[model samples]
Target: MSFINFNFEPSLQEGLDAMGFDRPTPIQEMAIPVIMQGKDLIACAQTGTGKTAAFVLPILNKISKSGSNKLNTLILAPTRELAIQIDQQIQGFSYFLGVSSVPIYGGGDGIVWEQQKKALETGAEIVVATPGRLIALLAGGKMDLSTLEHLVLDEADRMMDMGFSDDILKIVNYLPQKRQTVLFSATMPPKIRQFSMKFLHNPEEISLSIGKTAEGVTQSMYSVYDGQKEELVRHILSQKAYESVIIFASTKDKVKALYKVLRKEFDIEAFHSDLEQLEREKIMSNFKNKAVKILIGTDIISRGIDVVGIELIINYDTPSDPEDYVHRVGRTARADKEGEAITFVNPKDQHKFVRIESLIGMEITRNPMPEGFERGPEYLGEKAKSSGFSSGGDGKSKNKKKKKPGNKPAGEKRNSESGFKPRADFKNAPPAHKQEAPKQEAKKTEPSDTPKSETPSKYGQRKNVIDS
Candidate 1:
């Protein structure tokens, strides 16, 4: 049905018209009515499913009906990015309603707090914040929530994952005991269910496409050796179809490395916890403007970033956690646009791929490696030996002999002929046993460096380049 069917205020309708949102998403269609009836809600939907609007619309309606300009609503989000995003949505929906909303989170100047204090002083209607910063402000006697009429936990599972349960409970304790409570999560793990039971009062439960990837996204995986992931990533970027892409890696180092490699050919940016607040904002702004064509980041950018027109998401490294795979892919195919999610599956990470497929209830099609894309020797078989460096396995590397305590003496041993040498004390130490020849060591090379000297250069020169 059309948004007009929802009977929203003219102001909100105008804002929707401006945003070109003609209708409600499934979650919104099911949730807005129940929420408008003032019932608590527990919603389960994947990211990019209009979950934010589900609650924001109803909250705006309630505020408009009551016309109580006091601090009537509190929305707690897991990250600063999410907090800001929800706040922006609230502002968008309440654009003409004269409902004041403030977003409070870390990394911004205390200027936000000053604005929050002023808004509270002048009767702000909604306050969106990260739990930690919100609770701190409340405890410091700078903010009051006694008159709070509604409470919303956005991305509840992510909050728990980020260790905000205690802060959430504390924040709840500070709010009025009888306020309307709502919880939304991409996935409802047992912990989320437990939290919902503790907080919500006879909540209306809505599950839309539970544990599934967004329908608009085209999901696929590539089977490549672990060593050749960089090569595959480069090949994918070489295609002109992807206007903007976000590549997710499992670790900060990997994010930086991928960003460095991609930046050589395209405008690329990196986002991770290590970046300062200003730097992160700058990078995000650049990415949204398409000044940066590729963004290599950790899971931080997966959930809350609401940038539109992202054409593809590349999982340079398959997420070890199955839930993260969903979030990473969710970055694309947002709203109604079609998007593609390509994952690089090394042989050893097949189990993780299986777990993701099982959770999402769909097999990610395995396509042949792109032409000229080299699969490393390690990925030749169905299952490769664990790399041991990060995979936590002891194979050939662990089987190597350990030097005996007395095998080599403490001081330098002068040889009879040579000036200095390793003492040949093993003569009587043990029998001369046949040992397998040592495996050839893979060259110690940076990911940004050319795997082969003749590989075409994305950068001007064919010189060795180190990953950041």
Candidate 2:
């Protein structure tokens, strides 16, 4: 329960004390021992569960215990932000222990590249890097991992999702086969398990709150039309007094648009893949420093960027994948702190939210739409589920293969099904062959039930008689 129980080195203990990390989270509690024992591990934990420290602390302790200061650990992250984040956490955990690390990622200047190259060549005890940049460095034949004793793939699922598995395998080719491999992921999908099988040799697996959001987060959703989403977001932001907020849009365009709308009204910033790495870092720094109250971004900031005390998370666009919903909300309620996550569900995305609720094992509270906006769509969770692709926008069945008029089933009446009956005269009309009479000049047929004084025009307008 307590970090002291691990009996880490005095320096590590002092660093933990300084960081106020006295208690080990569930993932850390379960994962640290397995990792310290020099066993391969596969840990399933959600974001904000102190997963960074789970592996970082144990690796630092092992390195210190071995009295080896050479490169001993290689941590691969999914994104540059996450790589930097892991390096920062490593620094905090190894503050008094004197463990050195350099974050290897792209988008930095030539000076930063030279610095990374120097660090890799001169050897840091631990090197945290993104797979792509690390592969590039490895190909250049300037870095060395032959002395590596530990290999960690943090956020392993994300790495695969971002298409880094090939690079990871290539990087693994450079490592020694005797080293310990530890994989930590928010969710363990089949792909992750399969990937882990190749690298981890009979690894110990641990799982916690799989496919679910944190308990401290109060989850709710608002049903709104696409046109009213911005108004709804503005309403939510204005209605509450949140200290820090993150708005997750699905696309960079959406993030830009929301940032444009909210920047004039509040202290806000936008983060997306389009922005330069420096700009993204600056925005994140401002957000973490409380200079920016609202941070709107795509899923890029959903997992890697961990800012504590985030009071609110707004899903400006509902994530189609349920796992993403978990990560977006996980941005808040971190470190056992209570937070709120509000999601805006449009009609097309309503089904996706339903899937998220199912995956998380709870029904999200449906908030009432604010006044002055059009009514939101009905909750189509069950209807759309039971009848897949059956209903169209107007709620009509899209049965393109309708039965022909003559192909009606036996005893099925046409009028009863179609709501209309053919004229009775057609029932007794002569057969086609007998009705083919001689052709003649066109003549107007008189209405059987109309008065003679009234005449119907070609357009069906009637003319009145003068005497009438």
Candidate 3:
């Protein structure tokens, strides 16, 4: 269906036209009207399914009609990357309209914090934030959400995975009990369902293509030993068939290692939480502007980052979560364009890869190892005990075992910070800096003995607002 059929505010229709958005995807087609009616909604749709517009467009139209200057909407995202992405889209979608929004996330300088404070005080109409940063701001007594009318939780499942449940419930205390709530996530696990029930009052539900990848994406896998993995990556990049590529590594250390090796050969950059916030923004802009062709990062970039025309995605390491495998590959094959996703699986990860295949309901084609490379260890699915941060036996929590650094050949040493081993003869290599202390991987569930949050739940009972 075309967006024009919705008959949105003429100003909003103008913004849609400027965005080249003529037709609505299934999610948008089903979700936009419900949200326009100010009904609470829970939508399950995969990444790259145009879910952002499904909510953003309707909200902009409503805000435009009411013409209120006070903050009217609050959106909480799982990561700073997603928060920034959403803020940018809001800017584009509300171009013809007068809606304004400010992105609130950590890893920014004091000046940015003050600017956000000003936006909040001056009535920016919309606020997009990360849970932790928003909570921090709330504690500082600088912002108010008492007038917020719409609440959106994008990637709600990921928000829970990042241990933001209590943070979210805390944020709810500042909101009006009668506000409209909208949640959109890629997967609908039991936990997500419970979360929706806690906040939404008989929300209308919509699910489309859940746990399935876009048809335009061609998925494949290569089995290689740990040692030959680098060689395999080099071989693929040598083909030069893809113009833009994103490599997903398992950790920040792995991302740095891949970036160091690939930087000299291709225009590549690395992204992780450790980098300064402005540096990350510059890197993403460079990647989007085609100044950088290959971008490598961790699962943090796996969802809600929109870079158009990306032709290839290389998974340097398999994700333990089957759903994550979906998000990583979904980065490409977007906007109905054909793209390719390749996953590298070693002996220990074969079991996890199999689970991904099961979730997608299809076996990814196995590419034969290139000639002249040594054969990798056999895939011993059940017998292979995963080591070093492999998810639990069921693939849920992080492995608690301390990791030992891998051994290297004499004279070729790995930098503990970047995990990159330079050739002994490279004289111009940058000196490695000390690695920052690792942030808490994921917050444990609230301790039972801890005092209950001083913030009280305003909505002790849900009033169904879905018009029959």
lDDT tens digits, residue span 1-468, model 3: 789999899988988897788999999999999998889999999889899999998998888888787889999999888987998788788877767777777765566566667657766788899999899999999887888899999999999999999999999988899999999999999999987898899899999988999999999888765666775776677666456889999999989887777665556778887776656778888888877777899998998689888999999889999999999999998888889999988766888887888789898898876644455545554445444424322222222112335644433332433233333332222223423444445333211111122454222221101100
Task: Return the TM-score for candidate 2, rounded to 2 decimals.
Answer: 0.82
The segments of candidate 3 whose C-alpha lies over 4 angstroms from its true place after superposition are: 380-468
Q: Which candidate achieves the best lDDT against the true structure?
A: 3
Ranking of all predicted structures according to lDDT, beginning with the best and ending with the worst: 3, 2, 1
The sequence of per-residue lDDT tens digits that candidate 2 reaches over residues 141-176 is 978778999999999988888999999999999999
* Deviation (Å) of 1 in candidate 2: 2.0
Question: What C-alpha lDDT, on a 0 to 100 scale, does residue 407 get in candidate 2?
Answer: 45
Per-model TM-score on C-alpha atoms = 0.79, 0.82, 0.82
* Model 2, C-alpha of 90: deviation from truth (Å): 1.1
**lDDT string, candidate 1, 210-320, tens digits:** 788888899988866655666566556655645588988889988867765555445667788766565676778788897766788888898899988899999988898
User: Which of candidates 1 and 3 reaches a greater lDDT?
Assistant: 3
Candidate 1 colliding pairs: none
Q: After superposition, how far is residue 273 of candidate 2 from its true place, in Å?
A: 1.4
